[model samples]
Target: MVVKTLGKEDLWCGVVGGAALATGGGGAAMPREFFDARVDPLIEKGVKFQIVEPQDIPEDELIFVRLGVGGGIERRMQERCLRRFGVADWIREMDRVFPLPKWAEIPDEEWARVAPYRRLVELKGREPFGFMPFEIGPNVAFEIIRAAMLGKPLIDADNAGYRAVPEVSLGTLNVIHAPITPYVVATSYGDLMVFEKFLSWQRAEDLVRHIAITSGGGCSGMVSFDEDFIKKGTIYGTVSLAMKVGKAILDAREGGDDPVEAILETTGGYRLFEGKVGGTTREGYGAFTWGNIWIKGTGEYAGHTMRIWYKNENQISWIDEEPYVTCPDPFTVVDKKTGLGLSNFRPDHWPVGREVTVWGMKCADLWRTERGLRIYNPKHFGFDIKYVPIEEKVE
Candidate 1:
């Protein structure tokens, strides 16, 4: 049923609408508006995407973008920015400092001041928008800043699921276990600014007050990043999917039907666990987004609970407050309203208070064989998972 074609006309632009929903609440913040003549050319030219695999990629070509802000960091940064620089100029100033893919000039000392404020962008992946939410962790301050020293285009492709959570270690590009700098202590005063990077995610989060005061209640700077990883890991189809999920959900919702029903019909109804979010635990730290999605079911499903956790890089399941859904299983937070799922790369604040919804998880073995498997696999996201489809699971 999966058809591949570009500009093939009325061909059902699945990626188009899909890109929009991937953005979560922050989809509106995209630098460029969707459905414009500018983007049409790319769609027409045949731009193929295969999730984020280093192997399938041509070593020479590259693309990248940091999607979503860490938990509440965006809100704090926004508040601090508005207080000091005002809304109009806040985004403007951020743009000035973190211009797209261009080499920017910075004062060595000034860079130090804002180094910990933020890594400029974040990338997280999950089952959202019919594809995985490829993540870009918020790297540490100057210590691990790659793009800053080299300068890179921070592409506008963060079509992640929701938008909170900020653990830098969840990204695939990183080899070391250490997470990207999760905290940024920023200060700005009119044209004067200072920054300090912190290893602590919460401590850095707490500095919003100080930075707002320091930036004269207004802060601005081009966030720094790692240029190489951006090119290597950042997937290309963000915009394409954001716009489509809505219609997809609408159609699924229109038949007065439940998305869960649709999923069961399409995916063969693989049951992993059913419960409400609990414990406040999460997959791991420094994930583009991380939180414990507690699930305790009512009726027969009661007593048994699950921690649908993620590290922004991959998901690890916990049953009855213990880690059970370990590596390679697919875990996602679906929107109760539309029945659409967002990427795990969503910000940490996403799952908080979002009502008790179902968390669907599929394991690696579900997607191993060449022929489609009914079991859950990464490919169910519309991209290739580590394994192949299992007919037994699906059927």
Candidate 2:
């Protein structure tokens, strides 16, 4: 079996490249606090984060998709769950309720990260062979850490291709008509819920989203025992792709080269626009962050303005109020100088004068299919605009 060990540089690559592919959502790149709190502890124990090829996985082994739903009323949800369960501290209370001898020494935060996966194992009566991220984001670190904690490697693949999507229906598994249930969800305040079956992927999305709304946020674990199903339902080598993109950007920056040029070369993407942040409008509703960014052009693109609309992830862009690029074509805004992808979560990052570059790339072949466009297109997001490939729009 061929295995690749992910070093500190590789992990940082995942953070940077994952954020770039995140399209303005998918949580921020791994923060210093996260590295200190989670990654450092594992390294001190001699645990190496490893990525194994999909073909290397044993036929008998089961793989679980790890997903987290963000954007919720955290403080309110905490109060509600705590009051309902009569516990002052959720993790401490959970230890008292569903004690695990094997996890007795695990820190509370670490235990919370793996709780959903542990619950899945208990329900299935089978330990997972490895874990795969449902998408790319900060969760890339979480998945790697979870797999290492469970003495397993993370498969070099992702369910949401190279970028993160806003809803469950956007996952590759859904595109392939894979069943999502026989899943387990673990909320922040120690609530564990299991779904033995679900009516449909759409309904499952609604249910899980509501749970996230009520619980403030939570992680869900779903398993697939069929190797064939996994192979067909996931995009392979995306983890390596993320690392490659990140390394190229980092290398260019250190060499006193143009990071934007490095990004375009690394991803075969286009420089859609270069400008200063003109303004932005964002709102949090229905457990999702929705917003738009306005960029006043600069340099060669002077006098032209660009607008991007996003529901967690960038969905569409318009140049001078005319459709330019629309989803399932992945696009992002990044700091031109640092080459780091910016997140919508930080309004300050896009202040009026912040110079940035808008980069657009052709999405994976999966998203180009009719079925893929039906769910991911601008029309699906309530925009009347039709889906157009980025290459067609730019070239």
Candidate 3:
């Protein structure tokens, strides 16, 4: 019923708020110069950016999940390379070298025949398929831009709410049996690879991660699915949610209000802890930046301690050896003074003794289900504890 047109202000808000929703992952918030350079050019060419509420998306239409597949400085290098060479030119180069599958449209007849409700099985596509992103992030802009180029509309809902994850198969899309294959992976240097067959979500993720590593730091992927399948499975209303969060922060700075309170009030998030970064350690292997960070409480919470575990984004958080907030629910680290997000991608950027605030929010209802817990539970990430929602654990 309510649709939001994405203007310049909305775009800025979305990026900032979406970075918060990213929960310390989803790549760094796009630099203003990058957005103007990359997205503005498209706008000049008549590209329209609009966020459609899930209820408004026609059920029969397809939604493609678009995401970036790599990390580190190398990925940035790859992105710059990709931008230098246009998509058409990149595709041509990919075809010239790798010669993997190119994106193709799937017809209604083939899509309607998804083999009768099988839960966990390989997605055998009789034809080429596509889907749109169900998440928000730095990658989100690219998805929007690509969708505009391809002439399709993106759904307002995303599988992870605004949260970011390390692997492709971890989202509600995979849990809901949404097919991820017939997906295309494109790198900055113009190498392309396609995966049309995967028996399990892990295999799909593993394969994609491997490709990302080989293809330079990361690549872009497009996975198509029926919009109806993701309607109930995703976190709805994120477009408005992101805008509100972004605006809250901006308003705070302009009005001389406390940015931290602004964010907590807007998102219903809790300021779980405040501290200074003691140190951070992370390593890259298999498409994710995996690591842990130590923060020693400062000011009011002085003498307390906290540690967070992350795979691209913050996933497991512990305070004073007590299980704080783990996966499924989102937790993030924000600069204590500015309230801006800090990424795990580069720990050196955060440095030691930087003041930071940790916040936690409840994950989507979809992730609390028994099925959902099995996918993102703390134990799944090798922790011994069960995940308790941030709302339950905080107050």
Candidate 4:
């Protein structure tokens, strides 16, 4: 099996490229501080960050999908929980135990960050062969970090293709009707719940979202033993795609070329709009960041305006009151000058008067299928517009 070892530069590229494809959700790319504090130390200890293609894994190997439910509200909830739990107290107890005993012995503060996989091993009676991220974005680094910590390589695939979505039902695994149960959910504050069965994907989303709201935010691990299901249900090579896109941006900047143009060329995506952020509004409710970003056109788009509506990720965009682009085709808002994707995880990033560019890429072919559209299209998000392929809309 061929495995690609990642260096610091490769991981940075993954973070930036994943953020661009995140379509304004999936949490911010792993921050520099986080990398310096957590990942850097691991690398110093000779921990290798690695990834493997989906087809390279053995047929009988097990893969676990790790994901998180996050929104602006969840961040606030996290702060509240931290204050209530007392961070100093939690830190003091960190060294009180070593190799925590089984399930409940793990501290609440560390369980969500470290125990999901351990819990999975306990339930499965064997170790997972590799780890898979639920989607692209900072989730790339998240899975990489988890895999590195566990001395395993991450699968170079994601269930959400090149973009992140608000609902669990929107994943390609759901699109392919794969079994998603026997999963584990752990909150930041030490709550753990396991679902051995669920009636439907919608029900699972509901449960997870509610728990996220109540507990600030949390991580979830999904187990699958079937190789056929794993191969068919995920969009392969997305991690590599993110790295490519990121490298293009970096190379462009170093070579004094337009990073935005480099991004378009690398992904074959379209420049949907160029302007300055005119205004923005956002609300955190039902475990989602619901908002709109208005951009006042500039240059060739002068005198016009574009508005983007998002439910966690960019869902639909309108230009001068006409529907311009809509999901499940992924679109993102990026800083026009820097070419970095602006994150919806932080509302301040979209402040008024910031120069920006809006770009979009075609969704994976699976998302355009009748079933994929049913779950991801405008109607699913309560919009009346029909789904239009990004390519068609641009043309």
Q: How high is the CA lDDT of each candidate model?
A: 0.35, 0.78, 0.69, 0.81
| RMSD in angstroms between candidate 3 and the native structure over all alpha carbons | 7.1
Global Cα lDDT for candidate 4: 0.81
On residues 88-187, what C-alpha lDDT tens digit does candidate 4 reach at each position? 4643444365223455443554557656667778888888788888888866876797788888999998888799888888888888888777778876
Top candidate, metric lDDT: 4
Off by over 4 Å in 3: 1-3, 72-131, 187-191
TM-score of 3: 0.82
On residues 19-100, what C-alpha lDDT tens digit does candidate 1 reach at each position?
2222222221211233333345644654432223222333333333222233222444444344334434564566676553
Q: Between candidates 1 and 4, name the one with more favorable TM-score.
A: 4
Per residue, candidate 2 scores C-alpha lDDT tens digits across 1-395 of 89888887688777777777778888887675666676777888999889998877877678888765765344555454443443336546656776646644533444445677778788778887788888876557667877887788999988777788888788777777888777777665555778888887767778888887765444444555456667787889888888888888889889999888987888788999999999999876666878899999999989999999988888889999999998888889999898888888777778888899999888778777777777678887889997778888988
TM-score of each: 0.41, 0.89, 0.82, 0.91
Candidate 2 has a TM-score of 0.89
Error of 4 at 392 (Å): 0.8
| lDDT tens readout by residue for model 3, 30-70 | 77888788777778888776667777766566555665577
- Better-scoring candidate (TM-score), 2 or 3: 2
> Where does candidate 4 stray beyond 4 Å?
30-33, 74-108, 217-221
Alpha-carbon runs more than 4 Å astray in model 2 = 32-37, 72-112, 217-225
RMSD to the native, candidate 2? 4.6
Least well predicted 10-residue stretch by lDDT in candidate 1: 136-145
> Residue 48 in candidate 2 has what lDDT?
82
